[model samples]
Target: MAADVRLSSLKEWDDDQVLSAMSEGNRLALAELYERYWYVLYRVAFQKTKSSEMAEELVQDLFVQLWQKRASLTVRRVDSYLFGALKYSVIDSIKSRIVHEKFQEYQQFFAPQVDSSTEDQLAYSDLLGTIETELLKLPPKTQEVFRMSRFEGQTIPEISQKLALTDKAVEYHLSKALKLLRTQLRDYSFVWLLISFGQL
Candidate 1:
């Protein structure tokens, strides 16, 4: 009888072989690829973000996206593909962090000023009312998921398990809710001002 080849042997295989295996829905191949590349990618991400948690999340998210889109993915050079993706992911994460920090700073700068004006107070109150109304307008499941994530401070996995929905479905609903809310509230200048200042 012939000895069976171990999956661990694939670690010695070249990128093309691994990519082909991954394209064929081989979970072992995916695992191998992850094991091989995760540390390098994590290092790159950490160097870029300078936040261990953010770097870890970014790398994990990349793998998740890769798995989710594996069916249609075509890679000639796995190293180039993965490193390129990581680079772009780092760039996007940096951009998002910058925007968030700017918004937070803006909020802190204007928070003191907003409290001094009766008109500003009324506008802020109205904005909150509008946001509540918009939240009510979301689909029941979407609204529940959003509320759990935002109000109850539940993580996506927690919300998914609690609602018996897949993580992707939960994320979809949350994205949809945000899109709708943005659309509904886009026309309000006061809301934009408040948001820019981190008031809302």
Candidate 2:
């Protein structure tokens, strides 16, 4: 009877407990983790994307990625992992937007009507260039993953298959790569958002 009670008690926990379970490949644990970090990630996404739908998408994507890689996952600290993930995810998203905007600009240049306003466009272009340079500074494999996910918009599974890696390995690489980007682009939310989107 005492053992039963203890087991029941062990089933219930806050963020840290859920994370511990998640590390052990428990779906319920991952769900609990999603509940704990969703709002925080959403806020970060919102700050960067400035679009509720996009922010929601970003959070949703992050959780989905987490779930997909639950097996063979381990974390020393849940808070750091969650926040670091959010930071990287946000940066990836922002960088993707920058890339998309540049593509749009390219298309517009070839189109009939180009925007008359050049100053803001130039500023944004320069900012994007800076962001790209930072991305290039990442390790080659990390850069490849980031580009495949952010630029090519490949799914995690696709990336894993293409790279001949396990799903967990892919997740770890992404998480680690994002951590590096988070540290490098800590001050720039826009840059962070771009990368975060790519991260997922």
Candidate 3:
């Protein structure tokens, strides 16, 4: 969005200057800012999430959301803002995963007690529909990585060798896919629990 901004010159600008340019619709400045902080953010996120894929995904998407809200965003200290935002994102991710894990556990516990095959099949179909709809919205590579890792039970190293991507690249895509699906599926997660309890 910038009229004329060289990457070389932007690299020399401080965070305040880069943020100012981003507010003025400078795309290159945003990229420069991302390059500046991505590694440190990744390290911090990795420490908290304890997963390489989750850490990479968090750092990558942090800048994406930052760009989306650049016009209304106000940042006095870029580092503080980035870390604060990441902290909340991490909390939301943790909460969403807990909801999902609880639902899966409920399903396993009640699967043997359910008497109605018709309703069970219907519920599964509805759940699968929600999953597929969200999955299709992701990039093709992300889709492939998620399926290979989850459905096909492939490890990161296997996915990397098979897809000819570096392990980090596979982690990034898998992280993205998992995050997106978890967010979307969050809505239906409690409903699945309700069905398990026969409250529906």
Candidate 4:
């Protein structure tokens, strides 16, 4: 039970103590670090990305990197260091995504002449089908608002009038739908293509 007492006391330990424990390969110490920083890191990430899944993935990857590099990790203030690391990671992810989007735009410009194979057509159809399926998973009102705004070429004011919603309510639903789809379609290479094509 001595070990239990030690682990229990870890919650009250200072940064240096936690780092020492981590350096010594204590898994409990790593768990403590994760619990201590996950929420704040997630908040920082979410604030920047406005996507819950991206925020979650960033924090999870941060902890995984910390654990993997524990022996070489050096920090005078754990919270400051974690937040700084998170800031850089978020910036890098955003830059990479922007580059990916630009590349997709380039591809779309040339796609009609260069990529008209049956296989390419089938893949594009599959992506649109998947996007529609995910859109259906949204709340009924959100789904309708999103479809009206995106699919029907309706302006926000038009959508509000059509749905009998206040302008604010229509904006809220569109924001929610975009955030949800950003998470759901993150892994699809053609997601940017769809966005550029005005089909997202």
Report how far off residue 1 is in candidate 4 (Å): 2.7
Weakest 10 consecutive residues, lDDT, candidate 1? 191-200
Q: What's the CA error at residue 3 for candidate 1, in Å?
A: 11
Q: For candidate 2, lDDT tens digit of each residue in 50-127?
A: 999989987887787777667755767777776787776677567656666654554455333356467756765665
Q: How big is the positional error of residue 27 in model 2, measured in Å on the Cα after superposition?
A: 2.1
Q: Which ten residues in a row have the lowest lDDT in candidate 3?
A: 191-200
Q: Which whole-number lDDT from 0 to 100 does residue 113 have in model 4?
A: 55
Top candidate by lDDT: 4
Q: Give the better candidate number (2 or 3) by TM-score.
A: 3
Give the distance in Å from residue 177's predicted Cα in candidate 1 to where it truly belongs.
Answer: 12
Task: Give the lDDT ranking, best first.
Answer: 4, 3, 1, 2
Clashing pairs in 4: none
Best by TM-score: 1
- TM-score of every candidate relative to the true structure: 0.61, 0.52, 0.56, 0.56
* Local accuracy of candidate 4 as per-residue lDDT tens digits, 76-182: 88888899888877875675466456555655753445548888777767767777998898999999987766554455544655777887998788788887888
